[model samples]
Target: MFAVGFGANHFIPLLQVYREGMASSEASLTAMVGVYAAGLIPALLYFGRLSDQIGRKSVLMPGLWVALVGTLILALGAFSQEWPLYLGRIIIGVSVGMGMACGAAWIKQLSTDDPVAGPRRATVAVSAGFGLGPLISGVIAEFAPAPDFLPYVIHAAVTLCALWWLRAAPETQEGRGVGKRKIVPPVVFTAAYLLAIVAWAPWTFGAPTTAFVTNPSQIGIDSAFPTLVQGLLAFLTMFSSLFIQPVVAKLLANGPRWLALAALGLTTTAAGLGVAVAAALTGSVWLMLITAPVLGTAYGIFMVAGLAETERFADDGELGALVGIFYSLTYLGFFVPFLISMLVTGAENVFGMDPTQAYVGVLAVGVVVCLASIWPVSKAAGYGGRS
Candidate 1:
């Protein structure tokens, strides 16, 4: 929850800055918001497996402290210049990478020996965190007096409380108890890793859409409406994860990877179509609002399916490293679209398209990617039917 909240609070503010502060030509402002993912990939590569050797708590606690500092840096930077935002975001990327790698493992360790429950709990925690983070931040930023300072201050407090809660949580791993494990070099490419990468595009593209549609200038939508839509989207995504994850796990328990991949493809394609249609009918925020939940559900399904594939293919000893790789790729998707929007803004002098058109284009591309990949992903996962 803390990790999710941290991301939500910090991530949206950066987007708000891009929309409000910097000129459209300065795509760097938007790009900077996601550049942290670049730093995260390296950190995940280098330190991902260390948690498996040491204990989850040992790594997670320190990560939280770093995140707290990052929040402070971000808050301070908001008052100063944009460089602090970049620096703070990088720190946050590292912190979140560490937390995801270790935190998921910790949740799994704490679950009763049910293999089903372990992954389900991890899924729930992640979804809940992601949902809560942005929802709370959006609400606070929309409604609260000190939009910039208050959000991070609240986040810092939340992180402190999470740190306290973590102290009581039991450690998941005992180090090899011998000398430390040698650090493994980064694995840049693998078939499964590549699949995870392709699977992440729609998810990341969906993120900025939430912010864009909600922006008052771009869409002329109500300030509170976007936040409300985002909260509903978050809830649908999280709620689906809570229920659908275990079900997907059960179906794929013996490795129905192809079927799961196909489901992901279909659902994502449908969601994308919905977004495109919504864009065509831009006058109706009501219609666009309806699609938000569907998109969220599709995202949830894709996440569960992707994680299962990662888990199925990863070597037991390299679980943390493999998961970290998966996460890095996932966040890579997060960075690319923002970068694209920034670059486009620079070349074109402005994002001339209204919020609706921008999102429709994004969702259309996402749908096409998922549809095109379906056959390949299914073949790779070795599923027999569309089922």
Candidate 2:
């Protein structure tokens, strides 16, 4: 529920910004979508550890409230000037950053006995909520009379409802004999290999694809398609986690971490290359439809692998802090490209290429980065046997 609210609020207003007044050429559209992620990175960096010290519920409730306020700001932003969009995005980013770290940790704690089930459920909840948000928002925006106001109004209501539901949910972390600890932020490593996978796989396969689907020349594609595609990709990617996770958990669950890591790296690299090929050759909407699932599955594998690796490295006491660090890096992978796009408005200038093609170029870079990272990641994970 928190995930849904966060995801919905993140993208809907950005879409509206494009719809209302922003020129497609300005890359404001991409920046608007990207800024939420920008906010997420910092929150994950600084505040993610807070959940560890306090409690999951303590962090989560306040985060949701912040999200609600952000949504309200977004709603009001639609009426006021353009700057509200940035403000709302920043606020929503903070909410999501805080929510994602705490929420995932909370779910993990609830299902603690079963490691596979716990993480699987946590991943699904986050992914599904993210997917659903755009689907609902897109439908409402496309069909509803007052597109902008209604979608956000509905989002705010849903957020409140989630907040109410959470009031009854149990806290995963109990107040401990543990004394008040200093708020120590986790150190962030680039996780070059992991980051490569993220840049190539999730960014290329997941993020830019949304923009591709929105390209005008792409047959049967539009802004709505991007939103819908993003939703679908999120759902499928997370859903794969539900099934494959258990199998992986059993095989290398704790047995051979390097093998599991390598497999993920290879699969993600392949998927990125596949999408790049599909984009280059067919340029068909049907190809994109097919690529979506392939890429999404790859994304799921990468996410699970990354999280598992984080768990493998973390001490039990510092799990929450590590999770926060991991997520902050992940969000960084998610947003930096959109900021780059905003800087390079060349998408508007290209004659033969559509906005989607520009997106493809961005994705291709990610793919290349991923491919290059495999050897380094293998080294980092101590997969000398495989290498």
For residues 1-387, what per-residue lDDT tens digits would candidate 2 score against the true structure?
345433533354235435444444335555665677777777765565677767888887888888888887877655646677778888888888778777777776787577655545655566556545656665665556665566677777777888888989898676742344433423223454344333333442233233233321233343444444444433443343345555555654565644645456455546744664565455564565555455545545555555565555554455566666666655554454455454224654764556556556655665666576566555555221112
Task: Provide the clashing-pair count of each candidate structure.
Answer: 1, 1
**Clashes by residue pair, model 2:** 200-366
Could you say which candidate leads in TM-score? 1
- The parts of candidate 1 lying over 4 Å away from their true place are 1-5, 8-10, 21-29, 77-80, 177-193, 196-243, 254-258, 262-266, 280-283, 340-362, 382-387
| Candidate 1 overall lDDT versus native | 0.57
Q: lDDT per residue, candidate 1, 210-290, as tens digits? A: 333332222334444554444444444444445566565666566443465435635564564556456445655555445
lDDT of each: 0.57, 0.56
TM-score of each: 0.80, 0.79
